[model samples]
Target: MRERSVEHEGRPADPDKRTLRLQLLTVRNRLTADDIEEAGAALAGWALKLPELARARTVAAYVSVGSEPATRALLDALHARGVRVLLPALLPDQDLDWGAYAGEGSLTQVRHAGRMTLREPAGDRLGPQAVTGADVVLLPGLAVDAHGMRLGRGGGSYDRVLARLERADAHPALVVLLYDSEVVERLPAQEHDRPVHAVVTPSGVRRFRTG
Candidate 1:
């Protein structure tokens, strides 16, 4: 992951998240429950088709509880296919750790920095060198454009890690997961921002090659 430059100025203020939440709620209503389920199936199908996903020795994905459907489909597919998974572990220092996910039963909710994460203790901390060998990294974000520019939750943690990956030249391709409606035509961009290589939605997956 790369470091964020100049702080994430694009994130809306607290009031903005509130407003976005309302808008997202409206969008959610437009989608029937069955539609989301079908989309999840479609997303999983497309993800399994990716050569990277099929061959990845190490796969990283988020734990989605409420609105995040992409993670569920991805995690389930990877587990069924016997691909190794590394889930995010919150550290005391505001950094992320990679740990093996045993199964759905292994997850437990734990509070960290006022947020909840599915805890799965990793034996030891993984260094940059260790993650460099990963084949693909499934990124979580609110929105992503076809260019792969992503709008995240504003901590810049993911950006920091991605920056490190860029310097190491061992960076795995980034895939941002978004609901179909979250895919926008454009978003605010900054010089420090790194575009994802792909955007996976419930309906389908779109590839974005970088120069």
Candidate 2:
């Protein structure tokens, strides 16, 4: 098993970090359709509350391939607002292949990461180059805190992406998505952990300043 990369407070994350993440996935599965709709509504409202988000021209959002938290609502909202949307095409070696998300019918699924995807072919894809055009980036995370530290699935996909963003001098308001209760006062951070600029939850959005 992968060792815990984050330590919360004085305690490192439980040795079962992987198990916990998988369990979170299970919990996500148990959410009723109504619950998912409510959660998506809340998240969309929360996104709208952020002034910059309303003004963004391009955004990177996930396609809810299956039981994962549905991002279709948010993506539709963004598109309705005349914003361009992008979805990360899962690539081998844990890298991201970004492509334009024109709308629902534009996506097709093919195996990439042992999971399904709603993606378009990314011809001549460049990670940093793709992100340079985005004004907002919605990142997936297992958990988050008030301070904006994100716990990902531990694949290092996001870490590498964020690092590329930094290298390209892209500060496009990093936003991590999480459940309402996932935002705590603190979360563990290691030397390599990259912090986000804000977090989006079912309840609302919280911005984080330098710690």
Best by lDDT: 2
Instruction: Give the per-residue lDDT of model 1 (tens digit) for 1-211.
Output: 1111223345444554345545764675576667766766777777778888888878877675444553566687797788777776655544566666667775666666545444543445465345556789888777777687887666566765687678789768788877888887777676777888898886778888776
Q: Candidate 2: misplaced stretches above 4 Å?
A: 1-16, 116-128
Error of 2 at 42 (Å): 2.0
Model 1 spans > 4 angstroms off: 1-38, 117-129
Candidate 2 accuracy as TM-score: 0.82
Candidate 2: what lDDT? 0.69
What's model 1's lDDT at 134?
70
The 10 consecutive residues of candidate 1 with the worst lDDT sum are 1-10
Candidate 2: RMSD to truth: 5.0
lDDT of 2 at 163: 77
**Tens-digit lDDT string for candidate 2 (28-52):** 7777888877787788888877877
